[model samples]
Target: MRGHDRFNTSLPDDLIIEIFRRLDSKSKRDACSLVCHRWLRLHRLTRSSLKIGASGSPDRFLQILSTRFPNVTDIYVDERFAISPPPCIQGRKRSRDNSKVSSEESCGSVGNVDSPYLSDAGLAVIGNGFPKLEKLNLIWCSNVTSDGLASLARKCTYLKSLDLQGCYVRDQGLAAVGQCCKQLEDLNLRFCEGLTDTGLIELAVGVGKSLKSLGVAACAKITDSSMEAVGSHCGSLENLSLDSEFIHNQGILAVAGGCPHLKVIKLQCINVNDDALKAVGANCLSLMSLALYGFQRFTDKGFFAIGKGSKNLKNLTLSDCYFLSDKGLEAIATGCKELTHLEINGCHNIGTPGLQSVGKSCRHLTELALLYCQRIGDPGLLQIGQGCKYLRTLHLVDCSSIGDEGMCGIASGCKNLKKLHIRRCYEIGNKGIIAVGKHCKLLTDLNIRYCDRVGDEALIAIAEGCSLHYLNVSGCHQIGDAGVIAIARGCPQLCYLDVSVLQNLGDMVMTELAEHCPLLKEIVLSHCRQITDVGLTHLVKSCTMLESCHMVYCSGITSAGVATMVSSCPNIKKVLIEKWKVSQRTKRRAGSVISYFCVEL
Candidate 1:
C-alpha cells in the first residue's frame, strides 16, 4: 500500500499538466475535475485559458472564475443561440389577443433558435465582465447579430485573435468590428454565408493589412474580383482557407505576388487547377501547411511544383483528389522532408510504388492516413511498414484488398504504431490480427470491424499480447464467447469494446466479458439478440463505469433488465433502446434517472 501510494505521489504537477496538454479539451476538463478539489484549485491557477461557450452558460463560467481563479485570458463564445424573442417581436410572453406565430415565424427562421443557449444580452454581460480576454473563437454563431460582435470588439480590445466563422454578418458588422479591434491579428469568416464581396472589400480597403490569418472556407459567394483585390491588399495575410472555387489562378497569383509572408493555405473542394497551386508553390516560400483535399483539378503537376517550392511545408492533405498518382508521390518524396502528417484518403491511383516512395523518404512522418485507398494491397502495406519506422497512427479503413500479408507487415514493421485501424478489410482473417497482436504490443486502439474471417483466434491473440484500451470487433460473425473470454483475460486496461452484430455472444459471454474487464466504461453490443436479463444484470453489477451502452435490437432484454441496469450502473450515461419498453413513464423515468444520476455522480 505504501509503495502504491509513493508511486502515485511521485507523479509531479508539471508532468500531469504537460500530459493533459495533449488531451482533448473535454478529456482535460474531465481529468482535471476528477483529481479532487486540490487539483481543481491547482488547475484553475495553472490554466492559461478557459472557454465555456459551447452551450454558453456565462453564469457557470463566471462562477468558476469568481473563486480567485487566475483570470481566464482566452475566452471563446461559441455560437450564441437566441432564447429571447425575435428581432421583430417584443417580449417572450405573447399576447392573448394577437394570435402569436410559432417561434420560427417570430424569428423568421428556426435556425435562429437552434443554439438556444445564449442571447445578445448574455454576450453583452460577458463583454461587460471579462474585459482582459485575449482570444475569442465565435464559430457558427448564426443568430449573433453585428451588434453583439461590435459589443464584443469594443469590450475585448486586448484580443489578439477574433473568430467570426459562420455568422450572419454583412459589411456593416465587418466595418464596425474591424475598426474597433485595432490589435486583432486573426479572423476566421469561413462559411459566414451572409458575407458579401462588398463587406470583404470594406475590410480589404481599410484594415486588412494588419491580418495575419483569414479563413473563407466554403464561402461560395466569393468571386475572383473580390479575392484578387483582397489578396493583393492584405499584405499581412499569412494563412488562408478558401472554398476551392471562384477564386481562380488570377486571385491566387495576386496573393503570391502581394503577400510575400503567406505561409499556410487550405483550399478544400476548390477548382485550383495545376497552374494555381504551382503559382502558390512558386510564390509562398514561407508556406508551412497546405490542405488541398477535394481539389479535382490538382494533379502531379502541383506536387512537382510543391517539391520544387514551399520548402518549409510541415502538413499536407490530399483527400479525395483523383488525379494524384505514383509520380506525384515520387515528386513529394524527393522534395518535402519535414512533413509530419500526410492524409491521402480516396486516392485509388496511388499504388504500392507511390506508397513505398512516401514511406521510404518521409522518415519524420508521425501520422499517415490512407483511408479508402482500395489499390493498397499486401505488398504496398508491407512497404509502408518497412519504411515509416516513426509512424504513430496507421489508418486503412475501407481498404478491402489488404489480406494477411499486409496486416502482418504492419504488425512487424510499425512497432511505434499506437492506433491501427483496418476496418472493413474483408480479406483479413485471424492470421493478420494475430500478427498485429504479436508485433504491436503497445497498441491502444485496434479496429478490426467487419473482418468476418477474424474470430476467437484473433481476440485470443489480442487479449494475450496487446495492451489494448479500445477494441472494435464489430460485425465479426465468427467471434464467440471464447473470444470475449480472451478479451477479459488479456486486456485489463480495456475501457471501450464494441461486439455489435456478434450472433454468438449470449448471456454467459456478456456476464463473463463484463466481469473480466472491470474497467469497461463504454460497451456497444448492438444486435446481440441472445443476451437476456441475466447477462445485463451481471454487466450492470460488475461494470459500474459503463457510460454509453448500445443494446439496439437486443430483443431478449426487457424493461425490467433496463431498469436494473439504470438503477445499478448509475454512471450508464446513454442507453440506446430501439424496441423494448415497459411503459412511457418508465422510459421518461429512465431518462430522468440517468440525467439526475450523472449530474450527482
Candidate 2:
C-alpha cells in the first residue's frame, strides 16, 4: 500500500525495525524471510550482525550469510579445529585400523594442543564472504596456516578484534593482519607457535603503533629482538603478555622504554634477569597488575627498582622467583601500599620475615598464593592471618612446613575465604581442613590435590558447610570410596571435579553421582582401576546427559561393557576406552559410534 494511498501497515517504521532486530537465530530469520516475497523487500538491507555457525547447517548458513548479509559487521563461528600430523619416517606405515581413526576425525589427528584445522582457513573463507566484517575469533583452530590468516587480513578491511588462540599462524599472518586491518584494536595470538624474530619485526611495522591490547603468550619462537620491536612500535600498548623462555633483560627493557602507559603485564615463565626487571620497574610507572612467574634470576635490585617506580602498584606476583628474599619483599610491602593480590609461590628466599612485611603493610591483600614456598612456616602464616583480615583466597599447596597452626589461624581470621588450595600440603591434617571448612561457609571451590592427610571427613565437612561448584581432590591417596561418595552427596552444584588418582571409587559412587548430579557431563576416572563395568553401567543408564567420559586405565572395562554404555547414551559425544573393544551385540546396538572416536592413546 502506497503512503498517499493509505498504506495499511499496522506498525510504525521504528517499531518494525525493532521487531526485525529482535530476530537473533538465523534459522528463524530465514524462515520469516522465506514466508513471502514482500517481507524480504520491506526488511532492512544490511544485517546487524553476522554469525556463520558450523553447528547446525554449515553449508546453507554460510551460503545465506555470503549472499544476503554482504554488509554484516560481526562474524562469529564455532572454531572447533585440529592440526596436521608431524613428519613420519619414509618407510613407516599406518595399519588399516589407524586409517579408520584418521578418516573418521577431520581435525586434531595427532593430539596437537589446539583443535587442528578450523582456524585460519575457516577464517579466510569467512573473511572472503564478509569483507566488511569487524570481529573474528578463531579459538583452538590449529589447522589454520599463515596463508589462510593472511588472506583474512588482506580481505577484511574493517576488522577490529581478532583472536587466533592456539592457531599455527606465524609472523606472516600477523604482518598481513596488521597491514590490512588498520582499525584493529585488540589482537590475540596466544599460543601461536610459528611467530619468530623476523615475523615480529614485520608485525611491529604493520600494526604495533595502532594496537591498544596485544597478547603474545607462549610464543616460544620470539626473542629479545622481536620484543624490542614490540616495545618501540607499540608505545600506546596497555596490555602485554610475554610468556617465553627467551625474553630476558633486553626484551623487558624494550617494553619499559616503549609502553609506559601499560596497566597490565604478564611475564609468566619468562627468563628476565635483574637488569631487565629494573628496566620494567623504572619505566612502567603506571603498572597496576603484573605477573612474574618463574623468573628465577630476580634479585634485590629488581625489587628496589619496582619499589621505587611502581609505588602505586595494585597487584603483584613473584611466583617461583627464588632469588627474591625478605629484604626485597619488604621493599615491595613498603612501596606498593595499594597492593591487594600478592603471589610469592615457590620463592624460597622469602621466609617468615617476608610474610611479616606483607602482613604488616598490605592490609587490602585478598588473594595470596605461597605454593611450594618451603621456607615459609607457621610464623608467616600467623602473621598473614593477624594482619591481612581481607584475605579471601589462599593457595598454600606444598607449603608443608606450615601445619595446623597456620590453617587454624586462617580459619579464624579469613572468614571470607571462598577458594582454598592446600594441595600436597601433607602437614594440613584432617583437623585443619575441617576447621577451615567449618568456618569458611562462602567456599565455592576447593583443591586439596595430593594432600594425603585429607580424608572422607574433610570432604564431608566441605559438602556440609560450603557450596562448592568446583572441587579437585586429585592424588589425595588417603581419601577412600566413602569420602568420594560423601562428596557426590554433599556438593550438589558441583560442575567440575578431578579425582583422577583416587583408586577407591566404584559403582556406588557412580550411582550417587548419576542420581545426584544429572548434569554430569565430564567424568575423568583415569588411573582409578577399581571402576568396573557395573559403575559404568549405572552411569550410562542414569546420566544420559554425559558428553565426555575419560575411563582410561580402568582395566575392568571389557568390549561388551563399553559397547552397552555407548549404545545406551545417545548424547555421548566422546568416550575414552584406551584399551578395550566392544562386542558384536553392543556394536549392533550402536547406530553410528564410529563417528565419536579418536582412538590413539
Relative to the true structure, candidate 1 reaches a TM of 0.81
Q: For candidate 2, lDDT tens digit of each residue in 1-601? A: 3444232256555654456668887677667666455456435343657543234223223443466657677765544622223222112344677543332232212222223234443555577778878887767655568888888788887888888777777777788887787788788778888887887678776777677787777787878898788888888888887777767778878888998988888876456678877887888899898888777677888888888899779898877787889999999898887889988877888888888898888888899988788888887887888888888999887786888888888887888888888777878878888888798889887888888778888888777788777788888888877877777787777766777888877778888887786666667777787878888888778777777666667777667668767877767776666533645565566634433334665
The sequence of per-residue lDDT tens digits that candidate 1 reaches over residues 1-601 is: 6436552378777766666556678566667757676566556645666544544234333433534344556766564442222234333334577555333343332222333444455456556656777787766766567776777667777777877777777767776666776666787887787777777776676567677887776666766766776676788888887774667777777777778788888886464688877888888888888887776787899889988898777788887888889999788876888777888889878877887787777778878777888887788778778887788887777877778998788789988889977678789999988988888888889887888898999888988888889988899999998998788778878899998999998888777767678889998877898998889998888888888887767888877877787778867778766533544656666764332112222
Backbone clash count for every predicted candidate, in the order shown:
1, 10
Candidate 2: give the clashing pairs.
Answer: 81-115, 81-116, 82-108, 82-115, 82-116, 82-117, 83-116, 116-143, 559-581, 559-582
- Residue 44, model 2: lDDT of 33
Instruction: Please provide TM-scores, in order, for all candidate models, with all chains considered together.
Output: 0.81, 0.74
lDDT of 1 at 501: 95
